[model samples]
Target chain A: MQPNKITGIGLLTAAGVGCEENYCNFTARNSGICKVTRFELPTAKVKTDFAGLIKSLPNEALPPELLQMLNSDDLAQDYVKAAVYVTAEAIKDAGAAEKISSDPRRTGLIVASSLGNFLNVSELVKDYFMKELYKITSLIHGMNSYLPSRLGSMFGVAGPCYFVSSSCTSALNAILQADTLIKSGIVDRMLVCAVDVCLETGTFHLWNKIRVLSHRNESPQTACRPYCKTRDGIVVSEAAGCFVIERADAVGARGHATIRGIGMANGASDFLKPSPELLEAAIREALALAQTPSDKIDFIAGSASGSPHCDHMESEAICRIFGARAREIPLFPYKSFLGSTFGTQALSEGAFAIKTMNDNLVPEPLNIFERDERVAANAYYKAADYSSYHINNTLFVNYGFAGNHMAVVLEKC
Target chain B: MSKPKITREELIEKIVAAIKKVSGISIAPEKYGDNLFALGLDSIKAIQVVNMLEDELDLMIDDAHLPKFTSINAIAAHFDSLNK
Candidate 1:
């Protein structure tokens, strides 16, 4: 099968909006996590009032008529509007907005969302329990398919539309699906968008019950320390990322990064803890498909979201794949810089991979006071502005809830 | 004990406050005569206004009556009829 190329990428994160802004923040080691001021954390039971919230959503980028197509209160949802803004940004970056509109049948849209417009869902549940359901104008507004369908309508993309929901690995899985469609010749191009909004009070309370969220209310920015001895848990965050993937020869210009291979594995045993064997299986599958040796990988964009068990599981998997050389290879857990954006993370980290390839430097993991002893992989903790690093390829991993593991290999074009 | 009754002017004032709270834009004394929908009060914002007024006045305004709330005076008249 012919390879697929990531021609353009658009990112909306707490770190910054757009590719340039996010890359600048990454190089400077700036964490976008901060104390929550968007909504009230009413219950004292919920631990931390901290999150990575996009300071200013690009709502102004969304025209009123575009939102009117939803015909409901979905226009009030940040996640919905964010998907459109980032998609437009990606298509514009690809320089194919007009081309996409002209060939609508050949362009597919796939959206990955973990919570699926939970703020609206929360409001609907509240009204239902309060016996105020009569106030709801549209009942289907909070469905998972709402985003991709509405986006397809707004962007004039009508081919092979789908919504993938796999928690943290959602976006990476979406990328894998996009690669499949392109390789199978189902479509000439595909737009993959992932978004999650976890800042709402109801959502915060629900995640707090999971007991895997960080409680570093005093030090919000340094809360998420993946693979470190002091690592606690993920810092919930909200973000959206969009990517335009097309056939390698189809693009007029050279693309950002070429998709060498993608791999997926499920442990099928546990819901919370992942098996190292499965994780290794995913990474090895990707390496095998790419026909690239493990040593060819310059660095790893790890899926360590600060949870001790999850980080250790990934570390074990890395050791199994690279053996003792895992300690020598740099592992950059990019989530340390942007918190755990959940669904949007894999795509955001994919953007980071492209940036590293273009800028020729890997960034240091933030807030790693001391690395865990048992975790064998070298958690990169130095200035990585190496022009001579020969950074050509990267292995990006995403470990999701319910034993879902996905790995993707990206090569410099 | 039940709350005391409110005059039509006071009702209009409360409705304006609810509109401002929901829509984030203040309805001027002159624009009170203009259609709320024309002023960008969609169904969501309208429901929010009704909810805020329900909390402030301790009454339930069924959404069946939502369309009757076109202008500030119209909302005031509707509320007065409901109380009557």
Candidate 2:
């Protein structure tokens, strides 16, 4: 079977809403990192409270029909609201809403999340002791699959609907699943949405406890300085990236990008530390599957989220895979502008890759004042305008917790 | 200690509310005696109703009694027997 194509995309991030808004902000080099205003974290407990939080999208961010469907109650739940908004936008963008609604059984949905409704789980725990105040709302919120299942119901998708959670690589893995489903003829079209809302009190506290988050509260703008010598750690953020993926030959299809290759591997090493060996293997596997030479990869959407150890590991993997060409490829550190969005960041990067390819412009990585000599020092990090270069294929790499490495090759369709 | 007594009308009202709360399907007054399946309550929705009722009333409904929970009236009778 021919490779599947991403026909439509919906994006909601701290930077902006929808595809056009986000691409414009990204090309303008605007950073979405900002002060945490959603929840008041006690200053004494952590070094910084800065995060990329979309408390709620403005009414103008959504179409009038979508706006009417969403009420204040729905908007209050961050993940639920984000999932619905992005899915609707994606379906509308693909013009698949009516098609799917008419033939519900042909469409499926897969949602990915690293942490699903931490606030609801916290409430459920509390309500466990006080049964009188208990509500079944937690059931809807706490289940990661609930996001896709609800979207399936709302959008009239009667086919396979589920969730994938593999630490931070959840989104890419979910996308991979969509690719498989299409190739195997299980579903003609799949709606994939990856969302993570870590701004909630409980989830934020746990992330801080892990000490992998940046503590540069003083400079929130530069908090996520990926691959910089002075970089502290990742700045946790929230985002949702939804896509309408279908077979390339489908009727009325306008593919934004074709997924050429998808490679996934488990390092089976440390639970927290990433393994460079396995990551390099995953990249090579993707390149082989794509049937493209390493030199043909025009650019790489790097997943360096500023963690000292992980950045070094990712750099090592890049150097190993690309060898001498590693220093020449234009590698854009997406997390620098978007922050570490966990499971959703990869899908968000995929969106950026498609947009940049369409525009034929490579934006510079943000906040990398001093490149770390220890991590991919020779790697290229320069802006490329249309006159200087042309992008045909982009590589998106993501290394998740518990040693999960995922890579995908997206070619311009 | 004795279980607090609940009237049949009150039980039916709570059941109706629980059904609406879990499934978002309002139960008409005349449908109180109708089978929950006929009223559009699936197994999952029925269990959710049971869970909500259990929490609200602080009652430990038996597993065997689940089949009897087909209608609002049947659930009220089971709860009444437990209370007695």
Collision pairs in model 1 = none
- The runs of at least 3 residues in candidate 2 whose Cα sits more than 4 Å from the true structure, single-residue gaps closed, are A58-75, A127-132, A251-253, A377-380, A384-387, B1-84
Docking class of 2: incorrect
What value does DockQ give for candidate 1? 0.01
lDDT of 2 by residue, A69-162 (tens): 6656456677777887788888888888787978788899999888867666777787777775666766667877667777787788998999
Q: How much is the lDDT of residue A339 in candidate 1?
A: 84
Best by TM-score: 1
lDDT of 2 at B70: 78
Q: What is the TM-score of each candidate against the true structure?
A: 0.79, 0.79
Per-residue lDDT of model 1, residues B50-69, tens digit only: 66776687775643455578
Q: Model 1 off-target regions past 4 Å?
A: A56-58, A63-72, A135-137, A384-387, B1-84
